[model samples]
Target: MSLPAPLDQIAVRRAVEAALAEDLGRAGDITSAATIPGSAAARVVIAARQPGRLAGLQLAAAAFQALDPAISFEPEVEDGARLGPGDVIARIVGPARAVLSAERTALNFLGHLSGVATETARYADLIAHTRARICCTRKTTPGLRIFEKYAVRCGGGSNHRFGLDDAILIKDNHIAVAGGIEAALRGAKASAGHLVKIEIEVDTLDQLDRVIREGADVVLLDNMPPPILREAVMRIGGRMLAEASGNVSLDTVAAIAETGVDLISVGRITHSAATLDLGLDIALG
Candidate 1:
């Protein structure tokens, strides 16, 4: 899918800049500085070594462009495109030293986020024939939530709240702090502004029953097994939006979706996703 028009260039720039800053902090690329001629230009192809969905090509381009304004990127595949091994996703041509310097940082963002989108796409495809929607959780890299969540959308999955401030999520901890589930849910609904939605997490059937009785806007069923989840869906009976979360993985995601919950929020799709296999190869020009 095309990135949202009015793409957050500012946020994307900040992320690319921060990554460059981290890599070039103080010392700079000492090895490239020492070995590569400053004015030399090179052509490099970003090739996928494994099959997966692509995301963040623009960010990768931005990462290189920030380092070398004269650098040019020719994208052969857009974000959300399915790819096979050895696909040339993009070509970067610029000062050889700059290309080498920016390579890791560009691929760092590209590979990691693409991996998330790819994994999310797999889950999204698995549940596509069903009504369940794939979503992500608060378990995201700190400060990278916007990009990560954007990648989720690219994978055909929806996003949960960007953070705690965006909505009132009365989790188990909140319930503890507020004394009980009822108190927490009630307080959340009562104090939340009219525009805000109140969702609560329930770890047991009893908690789900309680939330259903009180009529929560959404109920997150945490760590419930398939049987329990199915039962919870029946118990809730559309009283609220039913969400199944906690330890969701590709192996069990289909089963979880079969339980008939409305949403599945998987943390591993973000926090623990492995970077997709990608590499920059210097092409003969």
Candidate 2:
């Protein structure tokens, strides 16, 4: 399926504005103002310094437009497209000061989000031979969860619960607080609406059995090794969706996918992915 359109423009603009405000501060771009003339116009190219999948192209453009509405920002490739080293992603032409001022903020969003997409793509590609799908957990940057999850989709991965309100996910802590797995699932079923699917986390095969008997919509197999995951999948017997999570990495995801789990959720895709290498270089006239 096609990925959803870029995030809400108004929200994007608000985020860009907040980033610019934090960056410019009360002094503004002193270096650019001191070194460049306000009327000077220049063209700059946004290029990837290393190879990776792309994301956040629209956010980068929004940063420039927020700074200078007249700035001409054009993207050569769309988000989710792969890039090689030295590939030009976009070109910007505008007042030299505006271009220089917006450079860091634009790249901050673009590179970081592209990193998320790239990491997600790596995980998705590693497990393509199986029926399992890669998904991202809620371990995302505090204010950027929506943007990061969108990047996951751009990379051919799926998103788990968007927020606590989106679904009923009974984790270990919830189980302990509510008494046990059966209690948590029963409470969730009693409290949640019929439309909301109930998913409970289980660490052992026994817990998995109880979850199945409790009639949950989905069961999360947390921290299960491939062998246990295989057994859990067999024991589940198509009764409910099975999700495997915890310690998921490029090195081990393929093995986990081979266990026949329905979904594999990785937290590091958004939480720990390194920013992709991208740079804004002034184009020679």
- Name the best candidate (by TM-score): 2
On a 0 to 1 TM-score scale, where does candidate 2 land against the true structure?
0.97
lDDT of 2 by residue, 171-211 (tens): 89999999998889888988998699889999999999888
lDDT of each: 0.89, 0.93
Residue-level lDDT tens digits of model 1 in 87-182: 999998989888889999999988988998898899999988778999998899988888888888878889899887888888888889899988
Q: RMSD in angstroms, all models?
A: 1.9, 1.1
- Model 1 clash tally, residue pairs: 0
Candidate 1 lDDT (Cα, whole model)?
0.89
Model 1 earns a TM-score of 0.93
TM-score of each: 0.93, 0.97
Candidate 2, clashing residue pairs? none
